[model samples]
Each structure stands twice: as structure tokens, then as C-alpha cells.
Target: MTLDPLPLAQALIRCRSVTPADDGALAVLEAALAPLGFACHRLRFGAVENLFAIRGQGAPHLMFAGHTDVVPAGDAGWSVDPFGGEVRDGRLMGRGATDMKGGVAAWVAAVATVLDRRPGLPGMLSLLITGDEEGPAVDGTVKVLGWLAAQDLVPDCCVVGEPTSKVALGDTIKVGRRGSLNAAITVHGTQGHSAYPQRADNPVHRLVRALAALTAEPLDQGTAFFEPSTLQVTSVDVGNPATNVIPPSATARLNIRFNDRHTEASLTALLRDVLAREAPRHTLEVSCSGESFLTRPGPFVAALERAVQAECGLAPKLDTGGGTSDARFIARHCPVAELGAVGATMHQVDESTPVAELRALARLYARVIEEVQG
Candidate 1:
């Protein structure tokens, strides 16, 4: 029998699997997969829970990657309980209804749907699921990938069940994602009386000048498969409450969502060079989420496009204009792409997906499974 995705989505949603907290979410999914002949591996790294399950072995190994973790529900004005998994007026409502959980359920149902029609799977099928995608990501997919490397179990390709669709299911598939770099710039200066203009070397003024120089130019015009790089200042801090005192130190945090034109090293050098000219005395600290990567339009991408056209009757647009995802990590190991439900409500209040849309997504994923193997 083909598994209905609705009930499965609800069951997963009801677990309250917020970031870094399993809350039986992995158990619920592992229990479901074990009955279908999957050898489940529950790997815990630090405080994060991850699951990797495989049903077959050898060539043409295909992996479905996702996370069961959902972001916090935020405030208290929901029409329904954030974790209730209630369906009202033909919509399934919950914290993870669209951001994920729903997509995860749909993919599992797709596996069942495909298994029902054929005597056996055409190739090895596996799932790399983590409960840390929505958190620090320190011990999530990054860790499981290390384990997979140790066992030499890397797949041929992967499809991440992130909510990539924009207006409808299967309307868009991300072929690549921009690189992300976070930089913290702190400028130290001399504090003095505000009345004496020459007595103070104000750090805030120096910080603003450095930031102005940084934002003065476009990172690039953009690339064919990617968009122009963007730098956004997330926070600026002086922490001084007095209006008459010149602050001695100022700090600012900014993020750059850059295309393949730059890597973490190159971008750091660019920032440091600019700061040297604009604020020579500033100290800089930087971290990287992941470097930009693209899976060129080849067999892997063609498979997903064909699947979307077959199920949704429209040619899906191949895009790369989104924030970072776990696909960045997978790209190092195998070709990867993303497709899932419409993401209009992801990470917002009263997040939800229509009942019919959820079912249709399962059908789409089932087709993707078949199209990729051939």
C-alpha cells in the first residue's frame, strides 16, 4: 500500500522536535523506516541526534537528506498549538509544516510509493537525517558526513528536502547557494570629553567610516548561475548610554552572502584590506558557514527538472538565490540539489501546508526518485 503523507506529517510534527532537541522525532521516523527494511543507524554527536538509514547497497546509491529540527515557535498568538499538528480547513498547521517535517514526511511516503510499484528498489536508497540543521550546526550533517567518509559510504548524488519552491510545489530547484561569511570588526580608540573636539579619537566614527568603505561598492555584478554578492550589516554596538562621552570602543557584525566569485579566504583578505585603509587600528574576526557551490546543469539537475515537469506540468526554474543550506556540505561529497513544498509559510507564525499540496509533493518526490535512477 502507498503510504499517505498526511498522517505521517502530523505524527512527526506533534513531536515538538525543536533544534538540538529530538523529543522522540527521530524515534518516530526511525520506527517508521525500520519496518520497510532499512538498517537504521542512530548517531549522536555531542548533544545533537542524527540518523542514517540505508535499504540497499552498491552502485547508483541515492541519498535523501534533511533535518527533523524546527525553529522555535516564537510568540504566543497562534490560532492553534504550535506543536499540536492540527488540521483545520484542509490545512495541516504546525511549526514545521512547511519549513520541513512536511517535506521529510513526503519523501518517506515517496519511498513507499515507489517501493509498492516495483519488486525492489532499482538502486541503493538512503536517508541522512539530522536534528541540528536549525541550530548551531556544529554537530549535525557536518559530523555525519565525517562518519560517512570513515565508512566510505558517500552516495552518487543527493536531494535535500529543503523548501525550495517559491510560488508552488516544484516551481524552483536550487542548483547552488551563495557562500556566507560573518565578520566582526572592532575598533579601539581614545576616550575623552565631548566638549574638546581634539581630545577624543572616537571609535564609533572610525567604525562607521570603515563600514562605509566596505558598503561603497558592489561585490560583483553577479554570475550566470548565481546572483551578485550581498553584504548586510546585522548589528552595530557601542553600548554607551551617555550622549556627552566619546566611546572608546565600537564593534559591528556583518554578513556577506557571496557568489562563487569569492571564497572565505579571498573575502577575508578583501575585508582586511579595506579596513586597513578605512580603520587601520580595527581588529577583525571572521567565520564561515560554507563556501558557494554549484552542481552544473547535468545529469543530476536534469533528473530533478524532468521529475518536476512530469508531476507538475511546468518546467521548473533552476535557481541559486537563497541563503545557506546543508547542501553546501553535501556538495563536497556528491552532486546535490534541492526541491520541496511551497515555502510561503516557512519559519513564520502559524506555519502550515495544505493537505492536498502535501500529497501532491509526495507524488512529485516519487517521480523524482524514479527519474534520477534512469
Candidate 2:
């Protein structure tokens, strides 16, 4: 019996599983997977719920990784309830309808379809679902992958079902992601009256010069499969109310989206060097979300391409452009790629996915599993 992804998706959406909150979303999935002979294991890490379920135990293992969490549904106006999981005009509407609950349901339905056809197929299939992807992301796939590795349950390759498509179902597949680095720089100086320009050091001037040097040139002209790296100054503040008093310090926050051309360490070093040259007395602090990574074209990627063409009738463009996802962590374990539904309305008011597209995505995932496991 083939499972309809709509009902499952609706059930998932009904659970207000906002970031770091399970709200029984994982339980809903576990219920569906359990009846399919999957051995489910619930793993909780620091207030986050996660599940790792396996249907088989052998080589040529394939893992499906995703999250059940959705970003907060802001108080923005909506035609339907954000958590109601309403289906109107052949589309399922909810907070996570497209960003991922739809993809999760599609994968479950696809697995059900595959196993119903070949109940005794060789090799293993598993799911690594987390409830922390939309939150801090600290206690999710990264932690579960570690547990799986300790148990010798690492898969050969993993597919993250993030909303990777651009315009159509198979139009694009994310093969990599740009790294994110955030920095806070404070320029120190002696404070004094505004009239005494020569006596008092102006930190704001030093800060402006430092930022000018940082933004004077492009980080890089981008790289193959990725766009040019970008740096944006998020804020510059002296926090002084008195206009006549020169502030003692100036602080600025900056963020950089870098391609594979630079590592977080290298970029930090570059910034530090620039600070030294521009503002010798400035203090700096840096934090990295994740380093950029790419899975260069190979047989695994070829399998994805073939699956996309055969199932969706579209040759997917192998892309490496997007914000960081769980794929960044999975990339360290194996060659990872991301593919799923069109993300046109993810995290927006009236988030939705067409029922027809849901079924097509199921077929696409089924084909991908077959091609990768064959």
C-alpha cells in the first residue's frame, strides 16, 4: 500500500514543532516508520529531540537526514492558521509545509513505496531526523552523527532533504554551502570634549578607517559553483548620548559569507591583519558558524543527476550556493548533497506546497534511493 504524503505532512504541520520544540512531531514520524519495520531510537540532547531509525543493517547504507522544527510563525497576517495544516485549493498550508515537513513526509512515503515493492531488499536505509535544525542546531544532526559513529552506524553517503529546488522540483541540487563568520571589533581611544580634537583620540575615526580597509576590496571573485564572497557591516555604534563628548570606544559588527576560496581561520587571520594595519589598538572577537565545503562532482553526484532526470524529467544544476545547513556537518562524514521541493515560501506567511508536487517529490526521492543503493 502506498502512503499518501499529504496526510502525513498535515499531521506533522499540526504539531507546532517550533525550533527546539518537538511538540510530538518526531513521534508522528516514528509512528509512521515503526510500522514499516524500522528500528527507531529516540535520542535527546540538551532539550532537543532527535531520532535515528534504521530498517536494515548492511553496507551500501543510505541515510535520509532532515529536521522537524520550523521557524517561529511571526504575528504577520495569514489567511489560514499557521499550525492548522489546512489543505486548500490542492495545497497544504502551514509553517513547515515547504521548508521541510513536506519533504520529510515525501521521503517517508517514498521509503514506504520502495519497501512495499522490495520488502527484502539488501542493504540498509535509515533516517536522522532532528528537532534542532531551526534553532541553535547544537544538539541535532551533529550530535546524532556522533552517536551513530560511536555505534559504527555511519552510512556510505547521506542526503539532506532541505528545500534545494529553485523553480521546479529537480531544477537545482545544493552540493555545497558558503561559510559564515561574524566578528565584533571595538576601537579604543581616550575620551574628551569634542572641541579638543588634537588632545583626545577619536575611536570612531579609527573604526571607520578599519572598516573601510576591510570593505575596500572584494574577498574573492567567487569560485566554481559558488558566488563571490561577500562582507557586510551589520552595525556601527558609539552608544554615547552626549554629542559634545567624544566616545571612548567604537564597536562594529560584521558578517562574511565566504566561498571555498577561504577557510574560517584564514579569513580571521586576514581580518586580524587588516585591523592591525588600520586600527592598531582595536580589540577583535570572531565566531564561525561553519566552514564552507563542497562535494566535487563524482559517481555519487552522477547518481543524483540520473535520478533527477529519470524521475523529474529535469537535469538538475549541481549548485553550491546557500546558507549553511546540516549538510555542512554531514559533509565531513561523507559526500553530502541536498535536494527537495521548491522553497519559494519557506518561513513565510501561508507557507504551502502543492499536493501534486508532493507526490512528484516522493517519486524523485524513491528514484534517488534506488540509484544510490543499486
Candidate 3:
């Protein structure tokens, strides 16, 4: 019961796992879990690494899901090596420290602690970890869930370690997530001299008109249990370097984070309608990352709330405002939620978590396992 998550967490952060690259990150986790009796399955799918480690069986299955991938450490300077896993001024400094290697470590250590107290759990305990989370996500949790379903290993309920906490280690629990869709619009027109604007069809002008209409109206008033659906244009490309020559085509990319009121199909139709009206000759390509999902308040939620209240002394707020995560994939298989440590610095330079908070989060996961199992 005296397990410290710091060592394991540091080991994970040191792997330099920038998405789709394991760099031995999964092996580090497997090493930590194997001695504790977990059957670690190293799953590789199309250059992406994943793991499904479980130690128990039967009803009330509690799965701790997370990712080992970290985003690239950009040009932003950090006092410590991004992969050094240094502890300075009580903070664990690294790329994945808080955004999630920290959470994954906490859960593993929590399991070790719980096992020390209760060697044999009454039900199943598992961990579904993926290395493709920060990448295209095609070869991660979604595929793992398929394999789990095929083998009848799907869990009863699950929690994703996605650093949902806003101000403190346990201040927030994400109960649902808005769906995500990415759109690419390419408007084509005949190339012409810039001096002859009236002679050539201007694709940039058409593209801007379409984008304006898409953003002119709000997706919706905020929905209960969710913020309003949002659409944002992320990129605009013409590929033409010369200002004197009119571009033959203009391309724009946009994303929509929508609520349960809309599905990918509905949102896609809406986008097409606007594009057809404004840029009839354009081509639109759309891919849905996830449709919005909500796990309604019930016994599972109550158990997580009780765990936070007891361990952290704060009644955690059940929230649903955030970008998409692997939770969106798990929600399709079972009731899933998100919880972990403070995320104020995730995906930023100097991303980190206090050593004290990491220990506290492990204790919280221990409590959560107890609450939900009973």
C-alpha cells in the first residue's frame, strides 16, 4: 500500500513518445504491470502501439483507460529537458506529465495499492491504453474496443485519464463530450491575371463567402449538459505565391465540435447546404472523428462523485466542455467518464504536475476503484 506513482510516471515521461512512436513507452508500462499479475497484451496496429492489461474478471469491471502519446514539444523553451522527467520545485516536468502519462501512472500505482489491501478483487480490473491518441486515432481505443468486444472482454464502466481537472486535482469530472467533425473545402476557378478581376472567377472570394455563412449563425444555444456546438475555420490555403496571378483554387479547412442534438450526418448536411448555395462548383470532404455522447447521471456517476468527495474533500463538478478524447470511443461500449489531475498546462511548454498531486490522484483512483466495485 506504499506504492509511489512518481517513479513509474517519470519512467513513462522519459520514453519520448511523441504520437505513433512508442520509443518503449508501452514496454515501460508492461514492465510495471506484469509483476503485479496483469496479463499484458502488446497490440500493434498499423505502426501504432496499444495495450490491454487486465488482472481480474466478472461483473462490475472497472477499466482505467489512457494514452501514452504526447504531443511534440514545440520551440517553446523549457528549463528542463522535455523528456528528462525532472522534479524541480516539487513539479514533475515533461511533455506527458499532466496531459496524461501522470494519470496513467497514478492508476497503475493505485491498482498496486488496492491489490496490497485486497489481493483478489471482487470483479474485473483492466487498463486499455493506446499510443495513437494524439495522432489520427485510427489505430487506438476504437480498434481496441472492437477486439475487446470480439473476445467478450468489454468492461462494465470505464474512466479515461485525460486531465479533466480545471483548478485542482479532482475539481472536475467530464461526463460527456461533444462530437468532432473535420471539413475540407476546395473551391475551384479558372486562373486569370490579377489585373483582370472581372474576367476570372475568383475562388478565394467564393471560399470566404461560404466560410462566412457557415459561421454567421451559432450552431445552437448552449444545450443542457453541454456548451453549444461550435464551428471554426482552422486553415485557408491558395498555394499560389504570386499576388499578380489569380489562384485557380482556394482550399479551407474547418472543424465542428457539436453536441448530442446533432450527429455527423446532420452536421454534414448542414455544411453541404451552405457550400452549395455559396460555392456550387466546390468540392467538400468531411470526416467525423466522433459523434457527441453523454453518460447521464446515474449510479456510475454517483460512485465517481463519492470517490472525489471523500478523497479530495471537494464535490467534483460533472462537466462536458472540452475537446474530444478517447472517451468518445469508449462511451460507445460502456458508461465512460474522464478524470485526472490539473491540466492548466497540458499541451504547453513546461507541462507538469506537482508530485503531491500525482500521489493524491493515485489515492483518488484507489478510492474510485473501491467505490465502484462495492
Candidate 4:
């Protein structure tokens, strides 16, 4: 019997599993996979619910990675209850329809389809589902991966079911992601009256000059599979009440999305150099979310493209333009790629996906499983 993703997708969407809240979402997946003979292991790390399910062991292993956690549905404007999981006008309407409970359902259904036909299974199939992808992400895939590594459960290649398609279901595949870096800089100055010409150090001028040097030149023209690095100042604050007073200090926050051409350490050094040269009296703090990663067009990627071409009739374009995802963590374990449903409604009110498109995505995943272990 061919498996359909609609029912499972609806079931997951109804769980109200907003990040750090299991709300029975993993239970829903556990119920579905257990009946199909998968040995489901519920792994909870730091209050986050995660599941690692597998049917077979050893070589040619294929893993499907995703998260059930949906971003919170804000007040109003939703035609249907965000957690109702309603099927309205041939669409599966709910909070995670596209950002990814829908994709998770599709992969499960695809596995069921393949197993129902070939009960013995092909190679091995595993799933890494987490509940914290949309949140701080410290306890999700990154931690689960450590456990998988300890247990020697790493697959030869992993596919993250993040909604990678931009226009249609199979038109795009994310083969890589840019690195992300955040920096906070505080420049100190002496507060003094505006009338005194040389009384104040004027931190605002120093901060502006520092920022100017940081954004002076493009990080890079562009990379082969990634866009040019970008640095944007997100916030600047002085908080001085009096107009004549030169603030004691001014702080600015910046975020950088960089291609493979740069690493977090290299970028941090660059920022420091700018501050030292332009604003010597400053303190800098930096945080790196994830480094850039790319699963170059190899045999595994060719197989995925072939599956997309066969199942969806479109040659997938390999892209790396999106923000960070769990794939960044999975990339540290093995070569990973991302392909899933259209992300048009991800993280928005009344988020939904067409039932027809979801079923097509299930078929696409089935083809991917076949190609991976064929």
C-alpha cells in the first residue's frame, strides 16, 4: 500500500509542540514508527525531546533529520486555529506545515511505503528528530549527534528535512550554508560638556569609524556555492539623556553571514583589527552560531539530484543562501544536505502546505531512500 503524508502531517501539526515543549509530538512520531518495526529511542537532553529511530544496522545507512518544534503562533489573523491541524481547501493548515513537521511526516510515510513493499528493508534507515531547532538549539541535534557518535550510529550521509525549496517542492536543495558570527563592541569615552572643545573623547565618533572600517570592503565577491559575506549593524545605543553630554560609552551589535571564504576566528580577528585601529578604547565580544559547510556535488549529492529529477521532474538547484540550521551541526558529523517541502509559510501565522504537495514530497523522499541504498 502506498503511504500518504496527509494524515501523519495533520497528526504532528496538532501537537502544539513549540520549542522545548514536547506536547506529545515525539510521542506521535514514536507511535507511527514503532508499528513499522523501528526501534525508537526517546532521547531527552536538557529538557528538549528528541528521538532516534532505526530499523537496521551497518553500512549504506541513511538518516533523516528534522525537528517537530514550531515557532509560536502569535495573536490573531489565522483563518484556522494554528494548532487545529485542519485540512481546509485541500491544504494542511497548522503551525509547522512547512517549517517542518510536514517534512518529517513525509519522510516517515516514505519509509513506511518502502518498508511495506520490501519488509526486509534496504541497508539501514534512521531518524534524528529534535524539539529544539527553532529555539536556542543547544540541546537538539548538536547533543543528539554526540549520543549518536558515542553509539556509533552515524550514517554515511545525512539529509536534514528543513524546508529548502523556495518556489516549489523539489526546485531547490540546500547543499551548504554560510557561517554566522555575532559581535558586540563597546567603546568607552569621557563624558564632558559640548562647549569644551577637547574635554570629551567622543565615543560615538570612534564607534562610527570602527563600524566604517568593518564594512569598508565586501567580505568577498562570492563563493562557488555561497553568496558574498555580509555584515549588518543590528543595534547601536548610547542612552544619554542630555544632548550636550558625550555619553560615557556607546555599544553596537553586528551580525555577519559569511561564506566558506571566512571562518569565525578569521572574522573575529578582522573585527578586532578594525576596532584596534579605529577605536583603541573598546571591548569586543563575539559568538559563533555555526561555521560554513558544503556537501560538494559528489556521488551522494548526485544521487539526491537524480532522485529529485526522477520523482519531481525537476533538476534541483544546489544552493547555500539560507540562514543557519541543524545541518550545520550534522555537517560536523557527516556530509549532509537539506531538501524538503516549500517553505513559503514557515514561521508565519496560519502556516500551511498544500496536501497535494506534501504527498508529492513523500514520494520524493521515498525515491531518495531508494537512491541512497540502491
Compute each candidate's TM-score over C-alphas. 0.95, 0.98, 0.91, 0.98
lDDT of 3 at 208: 94
lDDT per residue as tens, model 2, 1-374: 58989999999999999989899999999999999889999999999999999988687898999999999999978899999999999999999999899999999999999888878767899999999999888999999999999999998888899999989999999999999999999999999999998889999999999899999999999887789999999999999999899989999999999999999899999989988987888899999999999999998899999999998887899898878899999988988999999999998999999999999999999888888888
lDDT of each residue in 75-94, candidate 3, tens digit only: 86887899999999999999
Tell me how far the alpha carbon of residue 149 in candidate 2 is from the true structure, in angstroms, after superposition. Answer: 1.3
Q: What lDDT score goes with residue 174 in model 1?
A: 93
Task: Give the range where candidate 2 is weakest over 10 consecutive residues by summed lDDT.
Answer: 114-123
Give the C-alpha miss distance for residue 210 in model 1, angstroms: 1.6
Candidate 3 residues lying further than 4 Å off, grouped into runs, are: 189-205, 236-249
RMSD in angstroms between candidate 4 and the native structure over all alpha carbons = 1.1
lDDT, residue 213, candidate 2: 90
Runs off by more than 4 Å, candidate 1: 194-200, 241-245
lDDT of 4 at 273: 88
| lDDT by candidate, in order shown | 0.92, 0.92, 0.93, 0.91
Superposed model 4: Cα runs more than 4 Å off: none
- Screening candidate 2 with a backbone cut-off below 3 angstroms (N, C-alpha, C), the clashing residue pairs are none
